[model samples]
Target: MHNATVIALRTVATILILATFVPLLPFEAWYIRIFDFPRSQIFVLAAFTLLIFLVLRWWRYGIDKILIPGLVASLVFEAVNIYPYTFLSPVQVQQAPADAPADGQLSILVSNVYQHNVEHQLLIDLIQEHSPDILLTLETDSIWQKGLRPATDSFPERVAIPLSNTYGMHLYSKLPLRQTRTRYLLEEEVPSIKTYVQLRNGVWVELHAVHPKPPVPTEDDDSKTRDAEIVLVGKEVKGSDYPVIVAGDFNDVAWSHTTTLFQKVSGLLDPRIGRGFYNTFNAKYKLLRWPLDHVFHSDHFKLVKMERLPHINSDHFPILAILSFAPENKYEQEEPQPDEDTAEEAAETIEEGKEEAQEEDD
Candidate 1:
C-alpha cells in the first residue's frame, strides 16, 4: 500500500519501536527458548519481517536522503558486528608466546563439512596439515561417514552416529574418550558429544560438541526450542568439576544476547573478541557474512591460537582453536538469566503455548 509520505513515516516509526525490543534483557531475545522451534529461526524471521516491513514503508514515505538511509544504517548497526562487539565476547586475552609454544596446547577442529559436500580429500588434507587432537564433523551421512574411514583409523578412538538425515554427527579423538555420550539437545537428532580430555599438563577439560538446528523455515521453524536446548546445557554445566570447552555450528551469530547469557551462565569465554569474528558461513558470499560457528570455554582455558581454515566444498569454513590451562583466582558467582517465573506472565504464556501445541497435535 504505497499511499502517502505521512503513512510511510508512521510505518517506519513503528518498525524502529519494535526493533528496540529486540535486545531487552529476557523477554525479546531470550524468550524464544521457551518455544518448540530453533532459536535462530525465530530470530532471523522476526528480524527480516521487521526489516522488510520498515524498508517498504520508508520507500513509500519518500524522504530519500533522510529516512531511507537512516533505516538502512539502523539495520546495518543492528545486524553487523562492529567495534566494541569486536573479537566476539570475553574472547579477550592477556598474553601469548610470539612463536609457537614449545609444548603444544590442545587443538580442536570443529567443522560442519556440509552433508552433500564431497570434497573429503580436501578436508583430510586440512586435518593432516593441522593435526588437531580432536575433530568434530556435523551433517555426516553414511556416504560421508564411509569417506572418512581412513581418518578415523588414524585416531585410536571415535564415536560415529551417521544418519541419512543432516543431523548426523561424528567425533574422533586421540586421547582416551572417557564416558563420552551422544546426547540430543532437543526432539531433533541434533547430537552433542560430551566427554573428558586429559590435557598435556595433566588437567582434564570437559568438552561438548553441538550442532543446533538452523533457524531457516524448513521442518523446524521456531528458534525457541533450539535456544532452550543450548540454555539447558549451559544450566547443566554450572559449577561443574572440570574446566569446560564447547564447540560446534551454533547456527547463530557471536553477538546475540542468548550467546552472551550462555557465556555468563556456564562461566565460559569466547575466543573471538578482540581477536576476530572469523565468519565461517556463506564462504561464497564476498560481503554478506555471519560467524555461525563457535568455540566457547570455561574460565580455565587460555586461548592460544584461533583461525578460520580455508574453505572446502561446504558453505561453512572450518574453525580451529588451541587453548591452554588458566586456572581462575576465584570462580564466578554470576547467575544465568531468563529464569523468571512471574506467575501471571508464565500463566498467560504457558496457557497460550499449550493451546497452540494442542491445536497442532490435534
Candidate 2:
C-alpha cells in the first residue's frame, strides 16, 4: 500500500511536468496548442502537488528530490506567463480620469452567442441594460439574426452576416460606421468585419471584429489558420494611421504565445493586463474557463470600465468595456513592438497559413 501511494504521486508529477513543457514547442498542431489554454489551472495543480510533497516529507526520498525541483520549475514558468494579467504588474492600458469627456468615449459589448441557444430575450435585455455604443455578436445564424433584430434596430449603422456554419458575425453600432467591409482574412467560410467607426466626437476609430476558426479535431485540426489570421491582422493594424480597436471571440487565451505575439506585432494595449483574467469562455463551468473573448486597442484609448457580464445561456459570457479616447496621453503608456525575430516569425506563420489554406482548396 505504501509503495502504491508513492508510485501514484510519482506518475502524476511526471504528467504535470511534461504538460508544462509541451506548449513551449513551436508546433501548430491542435494537440500541442491546446496546452496553451490552461496555464492557470496547471499552476494551481503544480502548487497543490508541491504542497502534498512538503506535507508528506517526500523530499527525504531520492526520487522526490528530482520531482520536487521539476514541479517548482513548472510553477515558475506558469507564473511568468500569467503574471502580467495580475494586479501585481503595471497596467498596459491606463485608466481614464473621472472627468473624461463623454463624446470621446466608446463603450463596446462583445458576445459569442452559441448558435443553437435560443435565449434571445436574455441577450436582448442585457444589451438594453448596458447600452454600449457598439455591440458585436458571434455565432449568429439566421435564427439569431432575426432574434436579435429587436435589440439591433436601435443601432442605425450595422453589418449582418448570418450563416449556419457557426462563424456568422453581426456588428451593430449606434455611432456611424464608415468603410464597413466584411473580409475573409484566412478561411473563406470564416468572416471578419472591418470598419471605421466615427465616434460622437467625430474621431474615426478603426474596428476589426474577428471570429477565427479554432484548432479542434472538428475544425481545422491545427492552429495555423487561426494564428495566421491573427498575425495578418496584427500586421495590418500595426501601420494604421487612426486609433485601432480589435475585439471578438479569438478562441485563444489572453496569455498564450500567439496573443502575446499579436500584441507585440500590432503595438496594441490589452486592458486586462494588471487588472484580472476576466475569463469569458466556458460560462457554464466555473472550474474550466479562460479569457477567450478579448478587446485589444491602441494606446490612444484608456480604460474606463471593463467587466464580464451575466451569461445569456451561451458557452461564453459577454464582455463589456468602455474606453476613453485620449491620444494626447498615449505617450504615457508603452506600446509593445515586435523585434526583428518576432517580425520574421509572424511573416513565416502567415505564409504557412496561406499555403495550408491553398492545399485545402485543391
- How many residue pairs collide in each prediction? 12, 0
Query: lDDT per residue, candidate 2, 1-362, as tens digits?
Result: 39998898889888888889998898999999998998898899999999999999888888899999999999999999999989999999999999999999999999999999999999999999999999999999989989998899999998999989999999999999889999998778999999999988999999999999998999988999999999899999999999999999999999988998999999999999999999998999988899999999999999999999998999999999999999899999999877879989999989999988888888
TM-score of 2: 0.98
**What range of 10 consecutive residues in model 1 has the weakest lDDT sum?**
33-42
- Candidate 1 per-residue lDDT over residues 231-254, each given as its tens digit: 556656776898888888887777
Candidate 1: regions farther than 4 A off: 1-81, 85-91, 98-104, 328-362
In terms of lDDT, the best-performing candidate is: 2
Task: State, as a TM-score between 0 and 1, how close model 1 is to the true structure.
Answer: 0.74
Best-fitting candidate, scored by TM-score: 2
Off by over 4 Å in 2: none
Whole-model lDDT values for every prediction: 0.66, 0.94
